[model samples]
Target: MDLYFLGTGAGLPSKRRNVTSIALRLHDERGTFWLIDCGEATQHKILSSPLSLSKLEHIFITHLHGDHIFGLPGLLGSRGFQAGEKPLVIYGPRGLEQFVETTIRLSETHLPYRLWVSVIDGGVIFDDEQMTVTCRQLNHGIPSYGYRFEEKPKRGKLRQTLLQEQGIPAGPIYGKLKEGHDVALDDGRVLRSADYLAPPTPGRVVTILGDTRPCDSAEELAEGADVLVHEATYAASEWERAQNHHHSTATDAARTAANAGVKQLVLTHVSARYDEEGEAKLLADAQAIFPATTLAHDHLIINVPRLPG
Candidate 1:
């Protein structure tokens, strides 16, 4: 699994950064991509990345803010032009369904694929065999949310060496052993899979929060996450301004990550006021509190590796 940043700026688009949008690439996990947010000109930003509109199966909108949803109509229309027929599902706040329906209806944008729009409040919005996505409301000016993506635990490794030591050769029986089933060989010998199998490998947890201030819900959603993508819309010096806007400063995001025991923190939704040098200071401020912190930029691809047993 990997994460690709399409837009990392907060509020509005800028020369250095666009609005807030993130693509959670799941090619390795499920051969599909789950978009966290689609801000203004998001499709244009995806053109610069290696992502395809056809592979975008799911889109999770944080809020109804114009900056976070202005590109939805364009993206949906372009996906149809690209000949995408796969079913698309969108999970967002109550106003999201109306927004998409109104835009597509008024603009006469015809989508070839079936679209599933769900109004999500707080809870597990999506659950499949491989993973589960949970959402929680955050302390934002509007009704914003955060999503937690967690992969299911994988089966333990097959004890090939142990099987060989026990005079068991690879064959159809090996499949049963790998599936944690008791395999009876042609020679009437029963091989127990538990003896050869190790403990189940733990799954990776990724928490991507929407625009919010320092809140307890953010910490709860990000608890023990392998990667926590939080908003850092202001520098340390702008704490008052951040609070006024119900946004978080770099240090505020870092503190939340530390409290949540997150492994890595990727800060995004940066204010356009900060240039390259200012961004460095924002990164530094977060690193001072949480060492494993990185400031995200447009088109920044992050590889989220599975944890070692």
Candidate 2:
């Protein structure tokens, strides 16, 4: 999986960055991408990237803030114009359904595809064959949330050589064995699937948080995640302002990642006040606490690698 940052600025846009939008691409695993946040001009940002509206399968909103959801209506409307007929599901806090419904109703927008809005109250919001998503409310000005995407562990490869050596002809039995099912041979022999399979491949975990203050929920959502995407809306020295605004500083984000024991920390949703020099300070502050910290830029792509078997 790969995280494509379409926008990274906080509150508003700047020459260096747009607002907060990210695309979690699962093309290799699911042939689709899940959008996280739909900040202003998100569709415009997608135009510059390789992402397509047709391939957008899900959308997750962190909060009702304009910087996080202003572009949602436009994106949804344009998806129809682009001939995107795939059903799309949106998950977000309360009022999300009303917001989308109101906008669509007022605009008289007729979506050709089906859309479902799930008002989540934390816990496991999504579970499917390939992945499970959990959410936790965070200390934000509004009902902001952090999401944890945990991919399901994959079954091991079938031991074709072992089966061939046993004179077991390859056919439907191989599929069953690969699925970890014990099979009975025609000759009255029982073959344990465990003995004919390699170790399962561990799935990757990614946590993406909304704008929030340094809080326990943030750490909980990011615990042991392969990548923790947290907002660093200010430098360490502005902790007072960050706290007052319910936003995290660079140091605060890194500390949370360290406490959570995450493999890597990614800082985004930067305040537009930061220039190139100020941005460097944010990175420095985060790296001082957590060495594996990355300052995300607009259109940046970060790979979340699966664990080795």
Candidate 3:
């Protein structure tokens, strides 16, 4: 899986960054992508990136903040032209449904596809055969939330070499065995799939949080995640300011990652007040707490690979 950062700035847009928007590309897994948050002018950011609105499947909003949701109406309206009759689902905090309905109604925008908005209440919001998504409310001075995307464990690889050694040729039977099914051959030999397969591969966990201060709920949602995308709106030196604004500092984000045992931590939602040197200091602060930390910028893509079974 790959995380494409479209806008990594906080509160407002700047020369180096836009607002808060992230595209979790799942092309290899589901042939579609999901938006974590739709900040102001998010569609414009997507236009400059390698993303298409036609493939957008779901949108998850963190809060009702303008920077986190101002682009929702525009993106939804534009999707009707590019996505044809594709259905879209949006999940967010309370009042989201009303906001979407009001905006679409007031603008007199007609959509060609069906759109569904779900109010998030902190729990497993999505669960399918391939994955599950859980949410928890965070301390953002508002009704904000964080999401945990957990991929289901995949079946083990087929032991092609072992099958070949047993004089079995590749065919439809291979497909069944790969799916952990037992099959009987024409010669009346029963081949157990477990005997001809490797151990099941473990799925990956990705945690993406909305704007928030350092809180226990954030750490719980990020526990043992393979990739934790946490907001670092200030450097460690601005801890008081960060706390006052209900935002996390770089050190705060890193501390959560270290406590959660996440494999990697990505610090985003940067404040526009920082220059190149200040941004470097933010990275340094985070790295001092958690070594596997990455300071995100616009267009930065983080590739997360699966773990061995």
Candidate 4:
């Protein structure tokens, strides 16, 4: 799976970055893309990339802040213009349904496909065959949330050599065996599927948080995550301001990653006050605390490697 950062700037758009938007690409596993946030101009960002609005099947909004959800209506409307026919599921905090309904009603825009909106507090919001998505409350000004995406474990490939050594011929029976089904041969010999299969492969865990302060709940949501994408809206020197605004500083984000034992950290939602040179310092501050820290840039694509068993 891959994470595509459509916008990384905090509060407002800048010359170097847009507001806040992220796309979780799982086309290889689920044949669909999941969007995290649709900041302003998110549709324009997707226009420049290879992502298609038709393939965007799910959208998870961290909060109702304008910087996080201003572009949602436009993106949803654009999907209709683009002839998208698949159903779209949007998950967010309370008042999300009213927001979408009000926006669509005021704009008089009609969707070509079905749309499902869920305003939830915290729990397993989405669970399918390929993945399960859970949410937890965060320490933000409003009712904000952080999402944890856990991919479901997959079956291992069958060892063809081992099966052949057992005098088993490869055919539809192999397919059944790979699916963990026991089959009896014409000779009345029962074969155990597990004997021919290797160990199951563990799935990747990605935790993407919205605007938040340094809190234990945030760390719990990111525990042992393969990639923890946290918002660093302020520099290390602005600790006081960050704390007052309930936003995380660069150091705060790094500390969260360390405490959670996350493998990698991707910092996003940077304040627009920082210029190109200033961004370097913000990144360095986090990396000093956690080595696997990276600043997410607009349109940056981060491919997360699968976890080992």
Candidate 5:
């Protein structure tokens, strides 16, 4: 899986960065991508990338803030123009449904696809064959949420050599075995998949948070995550302002990443005041606390590698 950062600025857009939007691409795994937050001009940012609106199936909103959702209506409408007719699911706070419905209704827009909007608090919001998603309230000015994307563990490869040596020809039975299901041979021999397959492969975990202060809930939500995407809207020197705004400084984000034992930390939603020089300071400050840190910028892509067997 890979992430494409369509916009990564905080509050508003700047010459150096756009607003907050991210695309989690899973073309190889599921032939689609899940979007996280749709800030202003998010669709425009996607248009500059290789992402396709037709491939976007899910949108996870962190809050109702203008910077986080202003582009949603435009993106939703663009999907129809692109001939996208697949169902789309959106998970967000209470005002999400109303906001989308109001936008579509007022614009008199007709969507050719089904839009499933969920007003979620905190819990497992989505679970499917490949992944399970959970959310927790965050420490923000208003009600905000942090999302945890946990990929489901996959069954190990079937012992093809053993089956071939046993003269068991490969066919639909192999599919059953790969799915961890036992199969009965034509000769009435019961084949146990557990006995033939290796141990289950561990899945990857990714936690993406909205504008928030450094809190224990953030750490809990990111515990052992492979990648923790947190907003570092201020530099360490601006800690007081960050606290007042319920936002995290770069140092704050790094400390949380360290406490969570996350493998990597990607900082986004940066304050527009930070030019390239200030952004360097932000990145360096975070790295000083947690070495595995990177700053996310508009149109930047980060790939999440699979765990080694």
Candidate 6:
């Protein structure tokens, strides 16, 4: 799986970066894209990427902040105009339905496809055969949430060489072996699938947090994640300001990653004060606390491979 940062700035859009928005591309696995926090002008950001808005199947909003959800109405309307026939589901905190209904009513925007909105509390919001998504309440200025995306483990590959060595002809029986099924030959000899199958491959876990202060809930949600994407809205010198505004600094984000035992920490939602030349300081601050740390920028795509056991 991979994560595409459509916008990584904090508070508002700037010439170098846009507001908070991320697209979790799952096309190869599920043939759809999952969006997290659609900030202002998010659809415009997707236009610059290879992603198509029409393929967006799910949208998870963290809070009601303008910088986190101002682009929802426009994106929904544009998806219909762009020939999006598939159904779209949106999950968020309470009042999400009212917000979407009010915007569509006042603007008279018509959607071509069915729109499903779920305003839920902290729990598992979505689950299917392929993956599961869980949410927990976070400590923010408002009622915010953090999400954890866990992919289901898949069966191991069949040992073709072992089967060939046993004089077993390869055909539809290979599919059965891969599915962990035993086959019986005409001579009354039973061949067990476990004897010719490798161990199951582990799934990948990715955690994404919205605007919030450093809290235990964030750490719990990001426990042992392959990649943790947290908002670093300030520098280490602004610790007081970060606490007052319920935002996290680079050091705060790294500390959370270290506590959660995440393999890699991605610092996003950067403040506008830091220019291109000042980015190194941010990375250094985070790396000083946690060695596996990196700063995220606009249009930055991160490929998270499966973790080694």
Q: Write the per-residue lDDT of candidate 5 for residues 8-42, one digit (tens) a residue.
A: 99998998899999988889989999999999999
Off by over 4 Å in 4: none
Each model's lDDT: 0.92, 0.95, 0.94, 0.93, 0.93, 0.92
Query: Relative to the unseen true structure, what is the Cα RMSD of model 6?
Result: 1.5
lDDT of 6 by residue, 131-206 (tens): 9999999999999999999998877779999989989889988888888899888999888989888877788999
Indicate whether candidate 1 or candidate 2 has the larger lDDT: 2
Q: Indicate the residue-level lDDT of 231 in model 4.
A: 98
Better-scoring candidate (TM-score), 1 or 2: 2
Error of 5 at 148 (Å): 0.5
User: How far is 107's C-alpha from truth in model 5 (Å)?
Assistant: 1.6
Clashing pairs in 6: none
Scored against the true structure, residue 259 in model 2 reaches a CA lDDT of 100
lDDT of 2 by residue, 1-309 (tens): 999999999998998999999999999999999999999999999999999998999999999999999999999999997756789999999999999999999999999999999999999999999999999999999999999999999988888999999898899999999988999877899999999999999989999999999999999999999999999999999999999999999999999999999999999999999999999999999999999999999989999988778
The candidate scoring highest on lDDT is 2
Tens-place lDDT digits, model 3, residues 1-309: 889999999998998999999999999999999999999899999998889999999999989998999999999999999999999999999999999999999999999999999999999999999889999999998899999999999988888999999899999999999987899989999999999988989999999999999889999999999999999999888899999999999999999999999999999999999999999999999999899999999999999899897
**Where does model 5 exceed 4 Å of error?**
167-172, 185-189
Backbone collision tally, model 2: 0
C-alpha lDDT (0 to 100) for residue 88 of candidate 1: 93
Residue 210, candidate 2: C-alpha displacement in angstroms? 0.4
How many clashes does each candidate structure show, in the order listed?
A: 0, 0, 0, 0, 0, 0
Could you tell me which residue pairs clash in candidate 3? none
Whole-model alpha-carbon lDDT for candidate 5: 0.93
Instruction: Report the lDDT of model 6 for residue 12.
Output: 80
Off by over 4 Å in 1: 185-190
Cα deviation of 239, candidate 1, in Å: 1.5
Collision pairs in model 4: none
